[model samples]
Target chain A: MQKGEAFKIEVNELALEVTSHIVNSSEIFRIVFSDTRPPLVVIESLTNGRPFWTSVPQGRQKEAEFFGKLIEEKLKK
Target chain B: MCYYNGQKVSKTEFLKLLQLEKALKDFDFLNKELSTGFDYSLNAVVRPKEGEIDFDIVQMEWGFVPAYIRNREQLGKMRLGYKDSAGKFHPPLTTLNSTAEEMLKPGKIYREAALKRRCLVLSSGFFEWRHVNPLSKKTGLPLKATINYPYHITIKEHEYFYMAGIWQPFIDTQTGETVDTFAIVTTKANPLMEQIHNSKKRMPTILPDELAYEWIFGELSEERIQQIGSYQYDYREMDACTISKEFRASLDPTAPFAYEDLPAFELSL
Candidate 1:
């Protein structure tokens, strides 16, 4: 998906394989109650790999902020 | 400066390295090896009338310019070194990873190159990191460790290998000289690579010894890449051990380990 669009990620299960198929889907979840609401990201988690599903916003501002905090911490190295 | 499989090879060793041996004492060993890794450059501008293959070394940039940039600063900004490619300036999508599953479809640059302008990237070894331990819950410390792991799955000994690559010839907007740039093809990570490249579950599509030529010329059919994808060897088939290269005595294969140790983690799926 491009920068600001939201799409649902669908995970398929099979014998020994966990595949993610991005489905044609959308959601209207708002990050804040302000007039200009931020877009929410819906990412599907694959069962064969790491953690289960979690959503970040369409602009991914929170995710970006979290990553920025991580970088700042690592820079102290 | 890199080991193919496990054996260290120098520029002097390349020609002899290509000479594959059928068995010990085989007279045709040299010729067989030469045929596998050695091939002359073939491009529209360098097409041979009678058709000849001449294998030689040439310098090329690693990042592509898209044949659209007309500014020197913009071109320079795109130059990729290991650290530079990992920097904030480069977008995640542009950092040399576009999966075949995504690129095989129409309209992708990889699909375009695969259909028409396929080229080979010659290299001794590329790097991958294995997590030595899960991140410590208490300290929030990363246990990622760099390893000079060698490729040993498909060879009796160390031998140079080629990763499947595609290149585009672009004219430098300011210099007015033609330059070639390339990106390596990646696929779903094999079991051997899951521990390393732990962050991203992907690995480069390494061309097989017998199939390197076919892969380079787009002579390989879609069926071949698919079939080859199914044949990736397990980690057990490869000798995967972490060795330090940055710490003193780290480059020594016999050096004692100093990093955090964790139980072996294997990918089941």
Candidate 2:
């Protein structure tokens, strides 16, 4: 995906807003929870799927789990 | 410095252990997540109000992003170690662990956070690698090679302990996005940690249960902060063991957390 290409996906109770950024010649996909508190749950995944960096804010377990599963499902697709 | 950390307990268990079930009613984001490297986030307890030791745990990125980094461009430049010859924009140093000495020094990136924005990083255990060079057995000659043995360290008596930390809020000027990040405080390693973390001889400033309250809420001068930062826990109260090298390999969340009793290779002293 080109830099700034973004989209939103919703599955069941979780909603994710994914954005792409070009960092050092690699694409980093930063997927954040659309509905979350101050420290939102953000997953930074590489296009190659080698490194999946997930960040979950305090008090948002359900959102984090759903986000994780959604990323896994998307990767499979 | 602690790069990898493990928080094996659930939020309910952590709250019960810390006796914050009533004070903190709604927040339940903490879980059994393990970190192997940077760019990940962890939960930390911070005192947002003075005279109140009761605090709430918040998720913060492991690396501290200084406020001066206004946008993605600046972040990229800073990460690439960009700095003017006059020392403008600060040096490109790792923000994962801010040493106590560095925190006390004037004009340091973490000085303000050190004095004002202290917090407690909760962890069941932390990981560090020890460097060893051994002679070649086949050639019977000294080999020019070094092997890193990863160790998981934890307090002996406590299921979970607090490591002193400082946090900051960074806002992207362009997008107005905010991210809370933190850096673990480190001090001169105690006898045992010195042996384990031989290269740097630095260990996280792990506070005792009683001191945890003071670390978060107490008022003190720069000298007192330095003293608190330099305080060392007894090495006997801590434990360490070798873990699989896979801990250093990838960012897989499901990677094995098993500890090995012996190092993979024998070291020739």
Candidate 3:
């Protein structure tokens, strides 16, 4: 992915901006929320499509799922 | 060893200052305004994803709670410093900073996290204290009163920067709750830090902007990691000012005393 490329998704009143990049041979997705209390969620795919998520702030697990699904759907297309 | 750190700028200001605004896009998760103080939990910036070096500023418990601990009860016990069956008192795992030497060692607690979950702990500045006592002129003995000279240190050019860190995502087996935690990585003090943190002689790994990417994404060998960990940051690049001792007595983490400065003292033998 090119530098500075990003996309946005709105779900259940929460807006998430996402950017993808490859570091150390792994694809990493950074999802930033657009809320009063914005949380940053980082997702990396391991072997067999297993996902490794980091820094999903407290009380924001549902937001993570919504952002992940959006990213997954976009990747599928 | 950095017990107190301050971020004078809000997330927006930090992003703009670092030129990370384009990569981060928004700052909703961060606190709207700057809140500074000393605490066991801190809102730190991290880059956990590999492919793109972007920022993920999140609030993490400053102390590392190992994944094995099942509940807050056990965590509390550990925090109180454990006593073995043999009745010896051992220091509790107050894991605010994991030494660079320990992070690289095989079979160590931080080894896996060091290699995989590297992060950048953002801070505007950090606090350290020097222990000082005047010597008796004729007796050549130490004086009874010892003074702790506190100093606030920051990068001269940048308003904020990153400290090297490793993080873990911990799950409570009993409650099924997940929390992400991190510990700042420390190394032998640079000349500037040694003078301030006189007792411990250690300093947090402050990574320069140019090397932050390599720290997070580069495939580093053991030798390379050592070089990066122990690299002596230029003392001239930092600005350290002696601050009022009121910071040490204040219970409020956001106390205004942190902003007060005292006359600078020359370092001596």
Candidate 4:
């Protein structure tokens, strides 16, 4: 990773880190973004189970959505 | 100083992460091969702010300074030794690394900070010296040498690792310069380190991922802190390589240089 210039940093806390993995004879690069304490939205499942998903705060909603789209696009590739 | 460290984070990523573009021009260090010794040196350290679970990556001076020192001059005197009114000359104070067992004892200089100001020191690797008294060709007696072979040690497969550390903030009364200083906590050496750092028989408290997290966020009870502070990172998980005697000046400081006469380890890795 050092020679390849691959790097990973958490948006939640920006420590200088890099992560790399080899998959299917090809090197895959990923950047992981996380929130330390994210606001969660709880939803009632059909079987009365509570499932929670993270919510993006004001002004950062666009960044959250952008990352969501980026992940989706990467998955499609 | 046991922890002669290498913290080689590039400037571009560091600025982008910290959003410190304004300070970019003034930025230096974080790419140093060896970052601490008798003199002051800078290294990237992870410190948790008050009321914050997550930590910020900040550059802190490696030599710890106690808060009671009056000013910058006093700090110099305290570190380099100053003769007392009775004209007794004291030795230079070494605060680069603190003994994990002794740091928390009552009335200790590091006691208060160890309890409240725990932090993690980030390192690409650290350097330690091994003394080898080679037999003299003429007499077969040992020859005197100060620093023999130098070893650059790091955790295996870990690009960078965290060492347990305690930080203190110093405010200079004369210059009003407020800077964060830290001391790496060290414990009794594991077998591998027992060979490499033979003189001191001590090694930095390199924390694993889980323990590193708990050390920063766990309950601050004296026992818990001391337990983690005294952790001896398993020798099997470490990688030690002998570097050139001129490693501090070599282009590739960390590249392994094999010594033909370096003794084979009796203990298995």
Candidate 5:
């Protein structure tokens, strides 16, 4: 993303395009949000050093609990 | 002057940044989202026992408060350190932008912090405004009023910018909680800011990327500190476009003032 320009939704697509740019060169860009209905999300890997994405179950109480469980489960590995 | 949610922001933006609800809320959910790198701590970074720097994440309060006040009397004796309200301490030291001059003063609160407790304030932008008219002298009608005219500017950018600052470790002798507080640093405005700030002054000295580490730990020498004034960033490169009055309305609910295409206020000698 350019310094002065504001972020727009379409420009924020996951796939890379020739003209697209990331804001401020942040090494880690994680976008975690909740969507109730499924197409249960998944990620394989990256083509370049681009942004990383993730999705988890969404809820007020459930979101936090799920996040904690995910971390604990990951740590067990 | 600008507004957020229709209210004037004379009280300063520190509290708004530190609020837990706001901090936890993601950027896409809000009108703006500031990136304060993962390591950025807005509050106290709990030091690991045995004096080891854990680098573990912890948040901090947005503003600096010295760690020693135990009672009302102790808080009362603390200097409120604003250039304007130097001798008086009525409003108390809630939030403030510090100064390079104050940091160098032999026995000032800032000087001591500069030597031992330097800190970095994180933000994406700040607000400064140009005063068109003075507010009522008696009523203190608007914060925009009292500032030195022509040079006085007001800002309400719906954005964020990291400000250079310092912190002190405040230990509660009673509760035994060790909390850390901080202050922002202000310097003479750059040329462009001089035009908008109108008075050749801007608060919260902005540091460059290269100087980040040096500024935090390097020797507080006369030559090194002078760079803040002599070598400030180019103020002109940052452009100023008229922000929408609707945005202004959201910022100052009480003002209910509409945006007018009046001539820009000029600096008078």
Candidate 6:
């Protein structure tokens, strides 16, 4: 915890560098998957202090549901 | 920076502390088992409800933000370090841990807040790094190696505890926005911490629940506040264990990791 440290994580074989930053006065986690064919952008928030996706840009909403269900669970495990 | 866990704080227990049945709706709750203070992450803290003797459990940023900081731009510049007109770079002041002794001193950043904005940082356990120097294999003598052994320290049986803290209400001058931020107050380490957080030889003022209630709710003088701010928890009533170096990436960062060559210390009485 060095004041703005980034986290490295994987989701569906995609490596992501996640950093928490203030967004609209609340903290949010964001990642950009350059490895993807179109380069995906995924953003998430914690509700009731649990992680849930809030943004999956470029029409990936349908596929994002799969990742959103358990990011927090995956983190705790 | 401090790293701590904040999971499994009994809801009923927390409500009882605040005497509130249904406050804290939509709170970030600091529910993460492991969170990094470096991220300026939100964590649960108990503070006096505005104009009320009752307490409130709320989430505030872990890093202390001085009221003089005008905006988010200044905050970023301060944390990241900014150069002046002459190209001199000013490093960020460490906000993660404020020394209790100096908080009330004149012109200190924590002075005003420490006077009127005391709080309790709720924590399950906290992480610290110990500097362990190993011997050089070729010479079989001591080597100047920077080896940091991570440890998770907690109360003997309590699932959660509180650390003395001070908060400030920061206003973004440009936008007129505001947020409450705080820093964990640190005092000289007790014997146990002397062996664990060896680098700084300091530890957070981990107050017991009784003192926690007094910290946020009791009315006291400047001397009393300073006394509580520098209060040290008994080391014998605490526990410590080395954890995986790559704990941040691990599911259970607090899980004990035994070191083969780690020197064992006789618990300081």
Winning candidate number (TM-score): 4
Consecutive 10-residue window with the lowest summed lDDT within model 6 chain B:
B1-10
Looking at chain B only, the TM-scores across the models are 0.59, 0.77, 0.78, 0.84, 0.56, 0.88
Q: List model 3 lDDT by residue over B149-253, tens digit each.
A: 777787886656678888887777778877887888888987788878878999888888556656776788877776676655778788777666665555532
In candidate 1, what are the lDDT values of residues B20-119, reduced to their tens digit? 2111123222112111111222211111111322132333455544555565466545443223554645632252544656655766656665555544
- Model 4 residue B99 CA deviation (Å) reads 0.7
Residue pairs of candidate 1 with colliding backbone atoms: A39-A58, A41-A56, B18-B33, B18-B34, B19-B33, B20-B33, B40-B54
DockQ of 1: 0.01
Off by over 4 Å in 1: A1-77, B1-56, B76-95, B132-156, B221-237, B245-262, B267-269
Candidate 2 lDDT by residue in tens digits, B61-95: 78788878898678766656676778776656578
TM-score of each: 0.48, 0.62, 0.63, 0.72, 0.49, 0.70
**How high is the DockQ of candidate 6?**
0.02
- Indicate whether candidate 4 or candidate 6 has the larger DockQ: 4
**Higher-scoring candidate on lDDT, 2 or 4:** 4
DockQ of each: 0.01, 0.02, 0.03, 0.05, 0.06, 0.02
Docking class of 3: incorrect
Flag the better candidate by DockQ, 3 or 5.
5
- Give the per-residue lDDT digits (tens) of candidate 5, residues B193-222: 766675445645765533543455455576
Query: What is the lDDT of every predicted structure here?
Result: 0.42, 0.65, 0.63, 0.68, 0.42, 0.72
Could you give candidate 5's per-residue lDDT for residues A4-77 as a string of tens digits? Answer: 22221122333211111222222112223333432222121122333122221112223233333443344366
Model 3 TM-score, all chains together:
0.63
Choose 3 or 6, whichever is better by TM-score.
6
Residue B269 lDDT, candidate 1, scale 0-100: 42
By DockQ, the best candidate is: 5
- Return the number of clashes found in candidate 3: 8
Could you tell me the C-alpha RMSD of candidate 2 in Å? 14.9
